[model samples]
Target: MKSILFRFLLLYFALQVIPLDIHYYADVFSLPGSHLGYRGLFVLAHYTPRFFGSTPSFADWLVVAALALIGSFVWQRRQPQPDWDRWRYWVTAIVRYRLAIGLLAYGFIKLYPLQAPFPSLSNLNTPYGDFTRWKLFGMSLGIVPSYESFLGGVEIVAALLLLYRKTASIGALVIVFFTGNVFMSNLAYEGGEYVYSAYLVSLALFVLSYDAYRLFSLLVLRQPTAPNTWRLALSRPYLRWGAKAAVILVFVILYGVSAQRGYRHDPYQVPGGKGIVTGFYNVSLFRIGRDTLPYSAMDSIRWTNVVFERWPTISIAANRAAHIDASNTEAITAVSNLDKTYESQGTNGRSYYDYSFDTASHVLRLTNKDPRLGYDTLTLRYDRPDSTRIVLSGLSPSHDSLYVVLDRVDKKYLLEEAAHSGRNNHQLKL
Candidate 1:
């Protein structure tokens, strides 16, 4: 029974380390020099095998368990080892490092506040009911960045503790609590990370099992517990510290620096480049082919509000139904500005567009960001008559000539207002 358990775990963790996706290797071979930014971080974070589908699924685990069971049988038949203690120790080390690196990859992103970015202007104005459960969960964390950073700090500390053999149990204990909460939250919020979180929790449990009896005896039974003294001696200095240092260099230092640079320069979730004008504007006048439509809450065809983000993105609020993009996973890296879907994902209240402002021609070419909504594009020419007012004339997606007037809204968010008024020191006005 002991040998069977060890063999099964060895096979399971080996499968966990090896990337089974063909595309993962393709990405590895197509590396463009040493410029591994967020792209590299993603390659590390999403290391688990996905033989069944693109996203992590429980079906894959079930298959893996079956395979491990069969392999243990084969392993026992082919070669029966006299001692399994040394082999178990080494396999546990592999799992410990894998969990440590995985946690670090996610921790750095959160540490720098890039994982759940601050809500955009459009997100702020969206109705509460318009957002999906996963979006709401992320937004709640995004709003309190300090809290998010604290969580990241905890994860980082745990990962660091995991590198040393003596402190691995402590790190595993921390992860059992922290990542267990994450797993439950994902299940409750309809998030896409429940599978991945459970994977981490499993690894933590395996590591914790080594010292579980000692802890039980010390804490529960109120008895003297002997410390774990088994240590594998590496005679060479390179064998002892070199491997550990390399792991730290790659996982912590390199990944952390890259995450910081990404946050400072180009946030992966946010579209790149600046917009011509950025503000919230009220759709004062709406005209479609010489027919003027009065503002009505029930009018699906008429635009109510338009928001120009700092990036090359625009969001329009109307009564029209929008197809929600339900992808809640990490936006590791976007190939183009149009491919960045973090802002539009899990929201159905407004239409988001990736727009290019041709300042030379005074034209705006807008394409729907949500692929589920189909490829709808609009070409409009703008005229800013004054500082507060603008007029747009062009063809709509339906090939109808359209004329619209926009009035800049001097809207202030309470969160921003409180920040400016020093919420910690001064009483908030509202």
Candidate 2:
């Protein structure tokens, strides 16, 4: 019985260790342009579009399905020759210790001092920005006031609870809920399909399952009250110490292996930063900037910046704007309104802008409603007419709109007017 249980555990760990390409399968199977519904598992199983030849890769699907089946088998019915006494005790002890370690690690990660400044949402235009953006249901929930500190506090408390056995269960419960929320949100926002919410959800579920199983065995099954030889050994000081040490060593090795694989598998570390600009999107206050442009850049960008920021106030506006050409109509109209409003309120000087790539022209366009430019298009054509600078161009009826062509390659900004010629238009050459 001990050998069989050990083998089962080995098999389970091996399955986890295997680098199954679930994300690849998800991409291949996903319905193009559709949000993979609310449930993560459901999306994995059924959301693939058949028409586009999108279907789950056989190997990945098989692996996940098989593991789930095996887990169900283990959980559903008791073994005929159930040695609950020995197996239950060992499993419970191992799980408790692992939970402790996991909690401590999580706490440290969250509580670590901010060596780097918090990423500005203006700079970080991605789905992750949605996390910074507060929302309840579909409506805007206001700018997330002090989210980092609040979440950090919760993580600290949860970690503390998990470290002590007396409070560990409660801590696990809290972590389960909190991480679960993050996981769901990640899925909802279509964060990274590979390493985002799904990974956290899996870890949370594992902890929840192990803790719940032990709790059931201890309280309902009343396994602790039952007598056995292993229990007698466990009661001894030397054996107890040995068991704890063994558990710690095993977990340390497992964690090391997992960490190595995680580092190798993850291509993007942290997910937000300015670099070779490819894509940008914003939600609420959070923004996502990706290095790869998606086919739906226009809709995605508009939804992230304008729709999510203003929400219901612009909900009807967004609906009407969706069918229109984003660059020409929707974008122009929205920026015009924003410029008028801001100028009227005497807040014209300072502006917040979200820029994203234009897939058609391969140009980066600024989406700001500044009064100075009258909400005109600001096109950043990289390597245009020169390799050292990005040429900024704009179309306006009056005064030819100001352009600050920043030469990122040379670390200089050449300020000029769009349509004007000669050195006079270079107002503040720097």
Could you estimate the TM-score for every candidate? 0.94, 0.35
- Compose the digit string of candidate 1's lDDT tens values, residues 1-430: 9888888888887676667667567656666656377567667566666776567788888778888899889999998984567776877888888899889988888998888988899999899898999999988888877789999999999999999989999999999999999999999999988898999999999899999999999999989999999876656757757779988888788888888888888778888789988899999999998899999878998999999999989999999876788997764757578888888889887899999887888999999887766757999999999999879999887788999999999998986676566765555455
- What is the C-alpha lDDT profile of model 2 across 1-430, one tens digit per residue? 5545544553443344343445536543554443211112113322211222223223443455567557645753555455545654555444444444444333322233121113222222223322322122111211222344356457657655644445656676787778777657645643222232234344445445545766778889988743222442445678766755554453333333433343333111122223333222222221123222222434433222222122101110111121111110000011122332211111111234444555567565655544455555445443344543343444322334433233322111121121134444456573
Which residue pairs of candidate 1 clash?
none
Model 2 / residue 206 / CA error / Å:
6.0
lDDT of each: 0.85, 0.37
Q: Which residue runs of candidate 2 sit more than 4 Å off their true CA positions? A: 1-80, 96-106, 113-117, 121-146, 193-232, 235-430
Task: Give the poorly placed runs of model 1, Cα more than 4 Å off.
Answer: 21-35, 235-237, 422-430
